[model samples]
Target: MPGKSLSERIADFGRRLAVEAHAAWLAARDPRTPWPARLLALAVAAYALSPIDLVPDFIPVLGWIDDLILVPAGLILVRRLIPRALWSEFHAVAAAASKHPSSRAGMAMVLLAWAAILYIVYWSVRVAPVH
Candidate 1:
């Protein structure tokens, strides 16, 4: 890190994020993971692994929020909830990186979620008292 250039540091961060997401996915499926942690981990994995972005990249500021803030926060929370030893084991596995990492179903799930959000917004505007 001390010797790394800005681009190198950014690349390292990206790689670390990918590794953490991979680790979360691996941990979610493990029976050893506690249910609460597993549930959060699964959600994080689905979003991170999915090719489609939940908030589309064309949306400006909101687009990067999930990737930069949400996923990492979710991973941090999950890391705290999971036993350290188990997480360390999965982290190593994720870093070694034997993964296919396709998520077509995750794409469908993201679309549905966006539709539901849009519907809620529409309904709220329709029902609101017009001042």
Candidate 2:
């Protein structure tokens, strides 16, 4: 990691963030997680996973703002809300889980959803009769 290039380091950071976000999602649903922390964790995970953005990524300057600011802020807030020991446990669990690896099922699902949305929009705009 010390020898890694800037781009590689950034990528590593991104991967870690993804793993932690997933862990937060898991913690959010756990029966043992405190209610306040659970709510915060849920919000963090939802915002991170959401395809739709508070500021759409297409817009200049502001588009990437939420990604740059909101998700990390939410994660930080969640960190404070959860007990330290519990947070450490979740972090280790998340790190180990990240190592196990998985397929692109979530990506496939997202693609399918986007395709459906696009089809509906196209059908309504092109096929439906207008005034």
Candidate 3:
């Protein structure tokens, strides 16, 4: 790190951030996760994974604030909600998984899951019991 250029350090930080976000996603999906923790982790994962930033990078200092602050804060909250042992396991799994090549099948499954969830929500609302 001492001899690394600024860009190299930034790239390293980005990689670590991706690993953390992946870990949160894993924790969110795990059945053993407490309901509150799962909900929070899901929120964090969604926010982190989103391509649109709250403040666009063109905005200079303000844009990086959300990336450097909000995501890490959310990750911290999620880490606290999960038990230490479980979080460590999740982090390890996520780190190992990150080394693997990206999977289109995994992407399709996630999209399918979200579509199913949306359909269920719509169906329930369309048939709500209003006595």
**Candidate 2 lDDT by residue in tens digits, 1-131:** 35999898878977877777777877787888899999888777766766566556899989887777777888888888888888888888887873533324334554666788889999889987887
lDDT value, candidate 2, whole model = 0.75
Leading candidate by lDDT: 1
Candidate 1: lDDT of 101?
77
lDDT (10s digit) by residue, model 1, range 1-131? 36999899889987898899889998999999999999999888888889899888789999989888988999999899999999999999999976647566668889999999999999999999999
> Which rank order by lDDT, best down to worst?
1, 3, 2
Candidate 1 vs. true structure, TM-score: 0.83
TM-score, each model? Answer: 0.83, 0.67, 0.70
Candidate 1 has its poorest 10 consecutive residues by lDDT at 97-106
For residue 110, give model 1's deviation from the true position in Å: 0.9
Off by over 4 Å in 3: 99-131
Kindly give the number of clashing pairs for every candidate.
Answer: 0, 0, 0
The deviation in Å at residue 53 for candidate 3 is 1.3
